[model samples]
Target: MVVAVVAAGGPGPLINGFGVDTSCLGYDAHNVAQGDADNTSHNILHTHSNKSRQSSPGKNFPLQNNSIALEIMVNVPKERKTYCAGKCKKHAVHKVTQYKAGKASNFAQGKRRYDSKQMGFGGQTKPVFHKKAKTTRKIVLRLECKKCKTKKQLCLKRTKHFELGQKAAASGHQY
Candidate 1:
């Protein structure tokens, strides 16, 4: 989800909303001098929101206060059409799978240090995170080229319910 801080006047520059800056593109000294900055600023923001919505089409990120909530699609298909780095000349069909993290090795420096600290009979050596804010994790798609067998990963937006390969019974359904 995108984190946006709203000021008393209007939505300030986005702290981090898909790494996009929410600052009004039409802002300039001329507009402010003519006293038309406020009027044009909101229009520019609406234009930016339209472009963002069109770029993804699936995810509707909020840019202005009017567009506060929008449904997010979390279902992914088994196959995807993405650029292949290996043998394909251009965009080609690829096999899509959910990316999974491998198990961490016990011999890692952090693991070893944690083990030693626990053996010394300390109740809690490290600070445990309690105030969890985010409720969803970003979904990663592992794409493999059909011809060259090349693999690439793509990170997607965070969603409460994520599905891979099969369609979910209810996801962003307008009903």
Candidate 2:
């Protein structure tokens, strides 16, 4: 006996062994002959037959958009600890500036010798010295508000600089 399979939706394409055309009686014969086969087979392939929904459109365009230009200023943090006691603030600052030089070696070596002497077992022990590294660029900026007689200092780090740029872009401003 010839069996027919019909889909619930209007006539379109034949999916698997079933067709959607209601004009054909093949679906009715298949349902009567195969019974549960019609239901199980159609459910397995239902997902492939469904159409996808389109995404919603975005909002209206922005107006008065202006490019945001930033001048990043990097500075040392306040309340930082000093390497040695009784050293003048200027000396501390100078040491940080001369970080690239090997001047700090003497101070580091002196501290190590003092520590080893306190331990009382030192004989040609390795000298603990600060390794000379590259110097970082410092930022300086002075910001004044025109509306009020208020002035403020601003410092930007690497992460803060990128965050500022992202904020500008999110606000519909060109960065």
Candidate 3:
């Protein structure tokens, strides 16, 4: 049978046809090679071949299970070339911007109804909603055609941080 060992920065090892992570066994490459190779769920049995092999407590092991704090941000370009269904009706350069809601109008049907109902009210007519559960709002990209000045919006997934064509320089050494 074929036995393929996987380490960090490499794809997971395939025991049979499925890939599996063996780093959770608290064994590094040095101990892994000296121990008996067991492809079944990383239950390794340590058997030193020679007396010269000694475990070093000072050696650092690779981080297991990918427990790293990652910075995730959604960044979109300031300008994009896309289809403009306006006067041009063709692919053109579109100015990219973040979509934001405008001020709510008090003259709206709901607001008008609420305001009229609130007149000489005994108490609050409806229960105020306070159970907020979401942490982030879905981002929307406003695309305006440079030629036709046509505006469109593209919806994106939820993100904590959003940037437009701004790339921060690496502050430290990047691997």
Candidate 4:
């Protein structure tokens, strides 16, 4: 169930109905050259009401206005073939997993001070951030060498959807 969508302008990688060839979604090069923000600069989304025979709207590709749908195939297996520094060789099979943040410590100095300040405060003391711009986070992959067990971290480009392992067949292979 792959959906095919294309933008009107801009130089981007070509993608066929079966697969995506590049990681980039199309964008206006003129706007990008002026240093404008990415998502807020465009609004080219439209739904074709006459195309009722098509499968669910973007069942294969999710669509958003002014934004291009990037059909990146990022589903990686739990193991990978790459160079391992510990073994000092290439073609080493490394175990792959998502990196998770460690638990926050209650005894940290900042936490203690914030806790005391909020105990009898008339209003909130610290500022909370709300003006977030980016829609997706850069995924981090944790790799461990099977032989030496040396661990390493790799960061991927930012994207809206990310999957760790091979998707099940029943899910329609939407990644």
The best candidate by lDDT is 3
| Total clashing pairs for each candidate | 0, 6, 0, 1
Q: Judged by lDDT relative to the true structure, which candidate is superior, 1 or 4? A: 4
Tens-place lDDT digits, model 2, residues 58-166: 2232321211222333334332223222323221321222112234554687777766676756575566668965344333333333333233444432222322112
User: Distance from true position, residue 50, model 4, in Å?
Assistant: 47
lDDT of 2: 0.38
TM-score, prediction 3: 0.57
Off by over 4 Å in 3: 1-71, 173-175
Show model 1 residue runs off by greater than 4 Å. Answer: 1-70, 168-175
Error of 3 at 19 (Å): 27
Q: What digit string (tens of lDDT, one per residue) describes model 1 on residues 79-153?
A: 888789887868999999988999999999999998898886649988888998876677789999998899989
Q: Candidate 1 deviates by what RMSD?
A: 15.1
Can you tell me which runs of candidate 2 are displaced by over 4 Å? Answer: 1-132, 158-175
State the displacement of the C-alpha of residue 92, model 2, in Å, after optimal TM-score superposition: 37
Q: What would you estimate as the lDDT of candidate 1?
A: 0.63
Q: What TM-score against the true fold does each predicted structure earn? A: 0.54, 0.16, 0.57, 0.52
Rank the models by TM-score, top first.
3, 1, 4, 2
lDDT: worst 10-residue window of model 4:
14-23
